[model samples]
Target: MAVSLWHKKVIFFGGKGGVGKTTCSASFGLLAAKRGLRTLVVSTDPAHSLGDIFATHIDEEGQLAPNLWGYEINPVKESERYTEQIKSQFQNVVSPVIMEEIQRQIEAAYSAPGSEEAAIFDKFIDMLERIETEFDLVVFDTAPTGHTLRLLSLPELLASWIEHLIAQREKANRLMSMAAVGSPELKEKTDKPDPVLATLKRREERFRRAREFIVDNQAASFIFVVNAEKLPIMETQKAMEILVKYQIPIGGVIVNRLLPTDQEGPFWTRRRELEKKYMAEIEEQFGSLILAKLPLLPDDIYGRQALDQIVQMLEEQIID
Candidate 1:
């Protein structure tokens, strides 16, 4: 079968926690790398297990196999770096008094709840921008469904938000220019262009580009991993709705950890029956989007050898 994901530049694997998104992502990366495609598997989940699964330590980026790299985004580190970058941009542009006040406000904003998400989104953009340059395919192992949904929606949300900020900044700059009309030196400073306004415009454009890249069906796709269980099925349904709302392309759904059909005994039979019910629901709701169904493995999936099993399944079963 032709691999559908092979043609896409960016792909995301997301679902409820513990449904095996990381395994699927790593397996896909392994398969892609073995195919001679340069693949980078990045974990956006804060509670990262990508390193443990690969049996390798990956801080920013590390080679796991030939042509395959892994990166676990550190929110705290990225947040600190993002804050410093923002602070650096303000220097030599504003007076000392305004700079100090801006620094204080920035520090305060750093403590806000969504700051880490914002920082991670910036890093996410960086990874998306790296496609076809440093890597041929970028696979994201995202956080749980809700958190991942929020993260995916950032480009849309921030695009408009940044545009508004740019508009306000432009208005403020116009007023400053009007006030500076009396002094030639002040008018010269105001007419030259506002650095802050320029920065806002740059940010607006960046978010706009990110938004465009994400919504492009040919370039990007999102795969959701779900177990044939009640909560996972429900959460996956809701998450699919959110993705549809945002116009992010849905690659397909992977039903993971399915019970073995050959198992015997009353407990096994009962569990299979329960799974059957949920499986039917899955079919009814997501029939067209089903990509692959992975059975529960006998051994823990760690290291490249274990991952190869998953890769084999994906290689055989993934629908285009």
Candidate 2:
């Protein structure tokens, strides 16, 4: 199928830490960009390595390259953005005291286990909605598999909550408007309801739209980057199950750092032998979905030259 059906078609790279997810994501974005598509590589991991892979400095916005752009989101900056939006939308309806309390609550919420992940997810969805018009493809270098699953699952969880909030707001609005022209008894009943309900309704609508953009497969897809190691492979399998359970679209998997088995001598022979063993397991487990295999390079994978090699490797068919 053509990849264009996905409005935003985000390819997320996620797996066990140290599995070369950032390098793979950068290579994919570079390849897409080289093919004449405007591509953006976004890094959501706290310890971002996209900048290192691209050999360029990136901040919250982005830095331009030949055909690709890169961005490393700062959690503090994202938290500030979230707070500003909440304050602007609720300033008029919420009392000053209530607004202060809400700000404190939001800060507290950000410290919770999944708070940062949720904030990053919201920023990603916001970027996809607003800036997708400027780029043909968006590649995300996500955190480890565990945190990435939490990020992907946020859309469905938030969708249900937003639907309930919207319903409650609709009910409140009808009652409040009726109170404006009805009898004194009715007016008294409506006046007691909190005015913040209207603002809440608007917020819920925005969240609903974001959720739709995420769950719509035509707009998003996830790619798991894994190695041949036992732990990494197990984590990838578990991650696949979670993504499928959430109804998120799964793209082909990228098996990174595969050893070339056609070399001579004992050192090369042992390396090749070990690789063959894991390669067989990988094929048996995910044969139908393997997209690319990247061989382990002797030097560090960074800069345009190295990235180009990685791209070429990704484009080649895996040899069984």
Give the winner by lDDT.
1
For model 2, residues 1-320, the per-residue Cα lDDT tens digits are: 63542344577888999988998888878777767778888888888888877676766556557668888877777876876776687777677998899878877777676666666876877667654578777888999988778877776787688778867877867867675775887677566656566666665666667666656677777878888878888999999899888777777688888776666899988777777888888899888778888888878898989888988887565232
Clash numbers, per candidate: 0, 2
TM-score of each candidate structure, all chains considered together? 0.97, 0.85
Best by TM-score: 1
Model 1 whole-model lDDT (C-alpha atoms): 0.91
lDDT of 2 at 301: 93
lDDT of model 2, residue 162: 70
Write candidate 1's Cα lDDT for 86-118 as tens digits: 999998899999999999999999989999999
- The alpha-carbon root-mean-square deviation between model 1 and the true structure, to one decimal in Å, is 1.7
**Predictions in order: lDDT:** 0.91, 0.77
> Which residue pairs of candidate 2 clash?
6-218, 6-219
Which regions of candidate 2 fall more than 4 Å away from where they truly are? Answer: 1-8, 111-113, 166-195, 262-268, 318-320
